[model samples]
Target: MPIIYRIAASIFLLLTTIPFVNGQIFEHPKQQLINADSLRAEYDKAPYFGLYKDNYFIFGTSLNHKPSKENTNVKFQVSIQQKLTKSTLPGGTYLYLYYTQKVFWNVLEESLPMKDLNFNPGIGIAKPLFHKGRYIGKFSFQIEHESNGRDSIQSRSWNKISFGGNILLENNWLIHAKFWIPIVDGENNKDLLKYKGIFQIGTQFMTNDNRWKFGLLLVKRKDWKPNFNIIGEIKYRFSRKADWSIFLQYYNGYGEDLLNYKMFKSQLRAGIVITPPMFSDY
Candidate 1:
């Protein structure tokens, strides 16, 4: 059993067999994972998933290969993002689930006893365009899966797809991008494919009233060779649910044999998010 509880009981029986096999179109009984007036009407109608200011709250923690480390990688996460509709199912939809664990102790030279645990489920499609109500667009897809800990070692079951967007200037800035694809074909380990990627760029900011939020991410991978990655983030929201975030990252790795990946290592993350509030018709 123990293999992270059989991969978390097979992702809890595939999330209870996906609503009995899509019986009611994936059922959405007024979905409310967190309701602050339905997340302020999906953030007045889509503020990048309304800043997740509605639902999705589990927990998070991270500390990965940092400050001259030799394997003491620690990561723990539990996530949920549910909102069957508010718009998007047709072009911009959302349903995300996450479960992660990467624990390795100072045994980083790969003996044959290496360990890994990663489970991910994602569905996100976006096409929002609201100027007055504020919520930019152009996010296409993100499908993920990674189950590694050895089950025959075939790249440990893998898949990923991505396409991205975001553009909102003026009222406090916003810009985002993404591009990733790895439809199956594993084990080339170019420093984990330079954090595996097609490409990514990012930016987002909002302050005070919205409490606070800041972001930046830059990722690159043009088929190995000195690929790059960079990450920076900050977020804060006292009440109105809850939020706390911090992240710093850098990567440029490769060289399992001359492919040579290196950027030392840097990662320090702290996270917490809770939502539920904002419903008024007075």
Candidate 2:
């Protein structure tokens, strides 16, 4: 095995095992654990920021955590994300922004995209976001723009804009609903433009620390398109400087079946998130 791989494996093992050995395990009262869902309730009642439900604004970087057959650690990116609520209510409108630097192995072989900047920004809104401490409803509109730092005169740019929303029902059972609409002819005046939609339902569960989220995503899209997809993710707080998440998405329609492009694709994505220390609630 390569030396780098060996080192990473050792560190991962140590981080996972050492915590248990040195940390004190909490013994909860029988009544609390036996109840329907006292975990969130206890934390929510805390005086300070306990059960925070605000949207997240994530800014950080990502690398080729998962590689295609021809691309080995072929890409690197720096991205910014913002998730804001339209209101302080349990259910409200919201927005998220994501920007990245993407380098293609076939296009830019040795160097990473961090050196040559590529940007993608999206804006959207979700309504009645999280409601009744259990269910949340949302509708969002999204637009994405991608461009390389190179001169506009040299090469054409890439951009995609989509509008859609999802309605979520949160409870111990975890069943929820989702829908998305892709608006074509919405970008630069290119014909052959079309719109797409999707709907899905699934369930999710919470873990001990109350810091992790995991769920199954079953989805369906327009016919003549790939519909089935499996989704899983773990979001955790690494420290004050960094927050991390690992996500796995497997589906049939990674590409545009309409254009006969990328009809099926599978990818794994992992990213770190950073916040302004001045604003963070240390």
Candidate 3:
């Protein structure tokens, strides 16, 4: 079997086995486990300054299965936002800014030539949708730009309007969804929809102690012959007060980078995640 198939099967098996493991070992008192309301209150009280978002570094294989160049690579993402308007509610609106970059490093070669670089920057406003105790939710609308800082034939750039939301359920589960619409003409990226897709949806299953989180994300196009991308992530916090954690990530799909937006790829990575107390809390 192919490596991708084997990985997918392993993930499915692990997901199926997690409930049994949780039942056996995660039997702490219900009161001891942090609930959605308490978690929201804690995040609301946190000081809003300096790095107010999650940051991470991923090192993994490029896994470009096509007849193209493939190698090991590194990925980094940083996001920060500040409150623009204060409201009586616990979670309010804000101004947001985020940037993410991925670099392909030819580690097998002597000089480690970086094959490709993709940069994404987003800026806009965020607002609270609802904040009733354990059922808090927020949404953001942003004007985003992404590009591969190249010239001539290799240059790729586009601007988009994006909207996304984060909702914390009563059971401490989190649901995240986002959609983007390109603000460009056909001359720019006529085939972008074939690979980049229209929207993404994901869900997170949080442990009772708020120490461990498992997530699955799906990105797909809306056409009859659609393309899709899937990502699964697992993270474990070192301590209740720590701002960092161990992160394991897996991806199988296309559009890993702007340079290879139409290329299919798969990868597995392990790294450290700089996790703030709150994420996507407007």
Candidate 4:
């Protein structure tokens, strides 16, 4: 089997083998959607905003190299989004504005110099997916831009129009996927697509009471190549009542960061993370 399929199968087995307990302790996927909708309605006066993605700070050393300033480093990301519309639009879709920033710091070096900064901002709309009145997941469309802030030969940026969908299973397992078409290519990074694939997919599984979570992501490495950028993550929440958790991630392949998107790399990182109240109940 291909590496991608192997990772996927592993996640499937993990999610299936672990039994979610205390059915009364958590709401169904459909009910969670309803409650989210009701919560939105209650705060119709002001925009609802929260964390847009996993926020974490981690230190890592190359899996392919010995510990060194060039091979060891710290990485962090921050992402947030705000609802733009007070209520659902024509098709029960809600508009939102999003922003995300990723930074690479070579703190292991003498000067503690920074490596790269990726700025991501976008506008998107999302709608709930349902099967026989039961909410399943979400469908989203967005116009986004990402770039590593630099000048001339070193600068990189691109704009894309993307479509994404995910399946929420039993309020414990989630299968998320996205595909995007390049709308505008950066003059300096015309070959960016050679590293950043047009499509990506990931799966996440969480235990009941939201204590432990596992996630795996796969991104194609352009063309018909069998190789893929594989990212795996494991998180352990200190307490069900706290939003902070211990995060560990392993990444292997290209495009781990924008500045060196073309370089093949491998790393194992661990640190702390803060999830969103957006889905705290789950």
- RMSD of candidates 1 onward, in order: 18.8, 11.1, 10.1, 9.8
lDDT digits (tens) for residues 1-282 of candidate 2 = 256336534533332332210122222112122432332332233221111111122222222234533332223333333444323324434445544433332233333222233445655543433334432334455666644445533222444545444443332223455454433432321331222234556655544343445556665644665645554544555432233333332223332222222224444434432221111110
lDDT of 2: 0.36
TM-score for candidate 2: 0.43
Top candidate (TM-score): 4
Where is model 4 more than 4 Å wrong at Cα? Answer: 1-45, 130-135, 278-282
What digit string (tens of lDDT, one per residue) describes model 1 on residues 4-74?
54764454343332322112121111222223343335533432212121111122223444333333333
TM-score each candidate: 0.24, 0.43, 0.73, 0.84
Residue 67: error of model 2 in Å?
7.5
Instruction: List residue ranges in candidate 3 displaced over 4 A.
Output: 1-53, 62-69, 84-92, 133-135, 185-188, 280-282
Model 1 lowest lDDT segment of ten: 20-29
* Candidate 3 lDDT tens digits, 184-244: 4434456776677788888887777778888888888657765578889898986755556
TM-score for candidate 3: 0.73
Q: Candidate 4's residue-wise lDDT over 45-145, tens digit each? A: 45665666767789989988887889899888776677788767878788989887787888889877778889899999988666655556678899999
Q: Give all candidates' CA lDDT scores.
A: 0.41, 0.36, 0.62, 0.73
**Superposing every Cα of model 2 onto the true structure, what RMSD results?**
11.1
**Candidate 3 or 2, higher TM-score:** 3
RMSD after Cα superposition, model 4 = 9.8
